[model samples]
Target: SQTIHQWPATLVQPVGSPLSLECTVEGTSNPNLYWYRQAAGRGLQLLFYSVGIGQISSEVPQNLSASRPQDRQFILSSKKLLLSDSGFYLCAWTENYEQYFGPGTRLTVT
Candidate 1:
């Protein structure tokens, strides 16, 4: 009965501005959370993953960071955005090694 939720659905921002995307999972305990990005014609790229509270693993080096503030909450943030940061952001939770994604957030940096 675990459900994942992501916010804003879509965003358009100027370069050098701040960015914050949130993800939360309900009806689960000690779940694994992940953040991914997808660009046009590109496969889903793993950005970050959390195995436990405050334990985050970065898969790619970029101008972004991830944090697990609560057991069921994960956040992706950028201090300053870049044009190259535009993409579809996805949040997912893992259960038994299978990841279920949220609706996703589309971000456009201009």
Candidate 2:
């Protein structure tokens, strides 16, 4: 069975601080990976996606960036977080056109 994992289930950081969140999948290979963000009570927004190692695509213009350094590892980073960056971040992978999501990370920027 495939499983997705995300670290730092919840976070609180001051504005302008650096941020790093990680996501990984097990039991899957070359899956279509994606990163998404959801603001409080808002719909999910696609942030980044990768089809292969070192390949990344941005869905929206923002202060965040994503990297896929391995087949099953994805990382999201921000040089300096903005107050508006606070939200729920989700990592997902697609299999047979169906998407599976991780537990997600909730970030609060102060």
Candidate 3:
């Protein structure tokens, strides 16, 4: 069975602060990892994706960045958070077109 974990279910930060959110998967190997952000009343927008270590594809150019340093670990970071960056952050893995999502992290930037 494959499962994903994300930490700090919710977050509150001031603008221009650094951000770091982590996601990890268990019971799978070399799975496609993806980061998505959902704004209020909007569909999810892809932030980044990775097929393997050090391989990442950015779907949007924003204050967010992603990295995959291990087979099951993925990280999302921002050097300076922005007010527009406030939203629900989700980490997901895909087995073909079927995707499983983590609980998600809600961020509020003021």
Candidate 4:
């Protein structure tokens, strides 16, 4: 069985602070990982996805970036935050085209 993990279930940050979001998958190997966002009144959107260590893809022009440091760990980062960047963040791991998502992180920027 595989499980996904995400840290800091909720966050409240100022508009200019740095941000780091982490997600890890257990019971799997070299799984494709992804970071997704769901803002208020909007649909879920893919922020980044990774097929392997050091391989990442970004889907949006927002201030967020992602990296895969290990085979099963993915991270999302930001140097400067914005109010519009606040949203519900999700981490997912895929196997055989099925995506299993971890509990999301709720970020609020003010």
Candidate 5:
């Protein structure tokens, strides 16, 4: 029974400001974690992924970065956000090849 959680369900920040979004998993250990961004009515784009603690891989080139400080904690951070960064950010985990997603965070860059 694993559950993923993401905070700050909605965010509004100005361009060039810093951003931090957190995601954590409960009842699961060493699960493959992933970060994705989805534009309105569009498909999700993979951002980052972790196979284990301290091991992160980028799926695409972007202005953001990710870290896995603990076995169940994954973080997404950016020193400066851009207008194109605004979207719905999602945190997900894979179990037995099935993916489970969190409630998601909606970011609006002004």
Candidate 6:
């Protein structure tokens, strides 16, 4: 049984602050990892994805970046957060084209 974990289910950050969110998978190896952001009442937008360790592809170029340092560890980071960065951040893993999402982290920027 594969499962994904994401921390700090909700977050509040000021404008222009640093951001770091972590996600990990258990019971799976070399699974495709992805970071997606969902705006209020909108669908998810892919931020980044990784196929293997140290391999990442960015779907959007903004204040956010992603990295896969280990086969099962993925991280999303931002050096300077913006108000627009506030949203629901989700980490997911894919197997056979099906994706399983984490509980998500809601960020509120002010």
For model 3, residues 8-109, the per-residue Cα lDDT tens digits are 799999999999999999999999999999999999999999999999999989889999999999999999999999999999999978999999999999
Local accuracy of candidate 2 as per-residue lDDT tens digits, 3-66: 9999989999999999999999999899899999999999999999999999999999999999
> Poorest 10 consecutive residues of model 3 by lDDT?
60-69
The TM-score of predicted model 6 comes to 0.97
TM-score on alpha carbons, each prediction: 0.98, 0.99, 0.98, 0.97, 0.98, 0.97
lDDT of 4 by residue, 29-93 (tens): 98999999999989899999999999999898879889999999999989999999999999998
- Model 2 clash pairs? none
Whole-structure CA lDDT of model 3? 0.96
Query: Hey, what RMSD does candidate 1 come out at?
Result: 0.6
- Model 4 misses residue 109 by how many Å? 0.6
* Poorly placed runs, candidate 1 (over 4 Å): none
Candidate lDDT values, in order: 0.96, 0.97, 0.96, 0.93, 0.97, 0.95
Better by lDDT, candidate 6 or 4: 6
What would the per-residue lDDT of candidate 6 be over residues 13-57, giving only the tens digit for each residue? 999999999999999999999999999999999999999999999
Model 6 bad stretches (over 4 Å): none
lDDT of 1: 0.96
TM-score between candidate 4 and the true structure: 0.97
Residue 79, model 5, lDDT: 99
Worst 10 residues of 2 by lDDT: 27-36
Note the clash tally of each candidate.
Answer: 0, 0, 0, 0, 0, 0
Q: Which residue pairs collide, candidate 3?
A: none
